[model samples]
Target: MEEERLSQQLHEYALWKADVARNLGLYQNFLESQDNEDNELILRIEDIIESLSTDRIVIAFVAEFSRGKTELINAIFFADYKRRLLPSDVGRTTMCPTELLYDHVSKESYIRLLPIETRLEDTSIAEHKRNLDYWTTLPLQVESPDKMVEAFKEVVKVKRVSLEEAKRLGLFIEDMAQHLEQVPEYVEVPMWRHALISFPHPLLKGGLVILDTPGLNALGTEPELTVDMLPNAHAVIFVLGADTGVTKTDMDMWQEHVKVFSSGGKKGLLVALNKIDTMWDELENSETVASKIKGQCVSTAKTLGIDVATVFPISAHKGLLGKVKHEAALLERSGLPKLERVLSDEILPQKQRIVRDRVINGIGATIKMSRDSVKRNYDGTRQQLDELQSLDVKNNSMIAHLLQMTRKETIIYETRVENFQTSRALLMKHVKEMQEFLNITELDKHITAIRKQMEGSWTTGGMKKGMTQFFEQIRYNMTQVSYTASKANESMQSIYKRFHEDFGLVDIKPSILSMHHYDMRMDNLAKRAEEYRDSTAMTVSEQSFVIKKFFISIVSHARDIFAKAFQEVENWSKSSLVPIAVQLKDSKTALQRRIDNLQRIRDSKETVEGRIDELNQSLADFEARLKQLNEVCDAIHKPLSFDQPPAEAEDIKQQTAS
Candidate 1:
């Protein structure tokens, strides 16, 4: 909900910024007024928001000249995969970024390559299917976002190959040998630089996202995709070298930017502190090194005006299994869930807040404008002006009604954003804490206990009996663990719901503000009609002389009376508060009619967040319980090698008592 909201705000602000820029250009030519930097800053905020919204992460194995970017990607995303998105080597591996999306159906699956020069009107594709010679070098193109996949299939993947054998598919023995054995240079091939690659993955439901970006030379020399695709992805895992934290080039990339014109706004930005294993190897004290690395990340986040929670430390290369820690007993996969949760929960909610803020700001602007206009109308009454100026700066008074509204609205806007941010921060912090609490250290302790128990069980029960009992205990534990997971999941949903409601989310009763406003409007309209009827009705041909000559005068009198009435009310109320009060009252009535239409935006956001939180908790508990349930099943059915029946019973007793 928050992410959707932030995206909405960023988009709105982005559009507003673009419109402002367009107007600025026109005004420069026609009005010849000097441009205000302050105004430009406001517009830039919107533009920044837009940039954030459109960002699809493209992490170019960015390094100086050649620092093994392609090698890293190949190792990370494609080592186990059946198909290679792009042929990689020590040099010139990726001439183009092979963007991989998912395409479920499309019998004749083929590769589509789109050149950078391909226009919106041009619908062309360079396709190859099963033919290894042609498959590796096809150009892809598409006319619109609508046919992006079709273009990808036509240009990147082989079409209608039907899982043909290597020999039948005419796979070159030499090419296959070259592919298996690393060479100095990647195979020379024609590239559709702008083309995207779409194919199916065996494991993941959404399929795998493998972005084969071009060499640093092309990316730096002509930075198009970098700008275009950064904000598009759910998260960008910027793979920097652990050996070098922030080189001159890295700092430059962070600092120097193109003066790109934005029509939208910027919102979500995340940083990835990658390649920690290299630092771990370099520094003798790995703990000290890791601490320093985390500190550096915090410092970097500060420099970039982003949250540290947005930063992720991922050993993508290590996770790919190219390098495994000998000392480690189990797989260390810390960054995956961190990245997923950051994108899905934290980043998502921030985007939503940005959207809500935009709406509130827009309303505030209207209120401020109305109040400002009213003040200007009655500007220089020395006594009145002096009296009006003497009120609390933060009060909900007419003296600063519009300004106060602006601030109040900003508070309301920030409230949700702040809550989401806080929730995200707390959520991530606790999850990480959970991981740390049940880390390798915890596992090691359990393994140690199990080892001791196993020896005792072997001494007591015969090998056959011990083994059977252990298996039975494992099964019993698993069942109990599953039960615990189910219970925790149920509890979490209620907890998340309470958090959501605390932030002003409650029953779905209709808004009374708008209905009251409508009633007020009807009453006024009826009174006016009755007054008109009491006066006189005359034909156009025989109109009353008084009516004909005094219509404008009558309106003027009524308006003047109303104004005076407001002025008279100023002793108790406020002089500037009239307009905002009118707007609120009017808006209230309109809002009641379309209250549902007013967008329960915050409500929508909280709902998604609450649900996600509940699911995540359930998943965590489910993981823990499954482990226990397996142990229980093993205890009941068969003897286990890991622990004796007494040990299993001890654990189960403690759990059941809790």
Candidate 2:
């Protein structure tokens, strides 16, 4: 029953994610129907929807050798397989950071392994996945579990490598060399860079991505997994053996990699003390066993400098057996229920909220802007219709009043045109200011300074600090460009209002400054910079070169982004005030028409009445559309709850408890 409940929670999460995607698609379709007038808004919403579509809740398991990471995964998610899904035996099993996901499009079960030699190529695993020729494929036979187990063992394949080769591959360190007084002829190295296992597993099929990371050696060698994959996962489960407590390697992993989340204020990191069943038989009293487990949790938490509440003592082996055999007592004593609760209740909800906020904040802003523009158009049309209805062509006093009003309106329109010229000059000045903010010369200087810091006397610690500062400067400048864009938006809006109020300009939509894109670009650059810093495989020289190359590419891309923004601003500034100029011309034509109509009032009365009726009809239609747009905007801004229905996420503690 507990297992079924967990499955139901996953199903609900899938439904919620689908709802988000559907609503975003609806909004994008509505924008597209507007004939691409709001290109900036439409493109941004499209990007958001695309991101949400591919988004999956990735849960990563990290630990040293024989900590039962794979077994834990099997117990929590893959127990329905009825046999060991991944090779988890006495010796080394998982040799690469294996990712398990369901590829629905493929609809076939297989494991694809990338050649270890591919690391020499300058491409990411994500890029490598796109090219099938680079991977070795092993198809799984669903009918035969024994054959599948044998096929899975291919992941642990290794070849002897000379010490020189190992050093060149960034696998050797001083500590290992010191222990090896006699340099061995060769050392066994993983044959694959990465292993991708795709099967129709229940949890995986429900938009869940599981990253089963290998031991320390594999993580130390694979910079991409250490720096990018693990950090970006929705949740990271750091497993430690309860019998051994926190070893030196576990502490190193915590401080060097897992602790990096502290800076981001992320709460998805959890510590699991596995193999607790080993302590079960050490004492006879049930209370004594409970005290010992609590002691281990506290000791492990203190050693790792994490909250004791975040640590869970679990026996994955026992838990797997208990779930498979329906032994509720064994499953309860194994302590897997608490961990699963944290996963379904805590981590999943956080992911949902993050995705929900991103969609609502981005799409809601665009909808509000469009709605406001439409409302302004509606109000302007109504005012025009009212003025036309009030015009009395028979009264001479009314003729005088209309003539005087036309002159006043014309003067105000002419004055607005003059003010727009001044605003255009100011707009040019701001454009130059924004361009200066993104100047590459200053960025190059920053890069040169960082290069010097690394090339000179430097420790790894100092180099890390220098890299952080370098990226900080990059972000600072990028932020300045975004800030200036906002100012430009304000300037354009002021002009929009003057034209609308003084010159009777209507239907002028907000110009697309795209400041949000700038913010997103900066965030991506920061994430990449942090990833590069976390890398453990690269040599000091290699790290330096990689950092420099990354920055250079970012600067180049920054130049292109800023250049496009500048061009758009220039184009928008040129045309933003044209409505006022056009209005002035119309006013002059209307003044001449009024003067002639006074002499032929009898003849022109019917034509004037027809014009008034047309204005009234247009105004009525505009108001109706404006009201519909307002309702759409209201629905978007309405607050949404991210939690699942409590009954569906029902507590399974009683069934799984000891």
Highest lDDT, which number?
2
Work out the TM-score per prediction.
0.32, 0.75
**Winner by TM-score:** 2
lDDT by residue (545-624, candidate 2, tens digit) is: 34443444444444555565555555455444434444454455555544444434444555666766765786687676
lDDT of 1 by residue, 255-286 (tens): 43211111133434445565666666453676
Clashes of each: 92, 0
lDDT of 2 at 400: 70
Candidate 1: regions farther than 4 A off: 1-92, 104-108, 115-191, 202-211, 220-223, 231-234, 257-267, 282-286, 298-307, 322-337, 347-658
Overall local distance difference test of candidate 1: 0.37
User: What TM-score should be assigned to candidate 2?
Assistant: 0.75
Model 2 stretches astray by more than 4 angstroms: 1-10, 104-109, 130-133, 140-150, 378-635, 643-658
Residue 141 in model 2: shift from native, Å?
5.0
Q: What is the lDDT of residue 278 in candidate 1?
A: 62
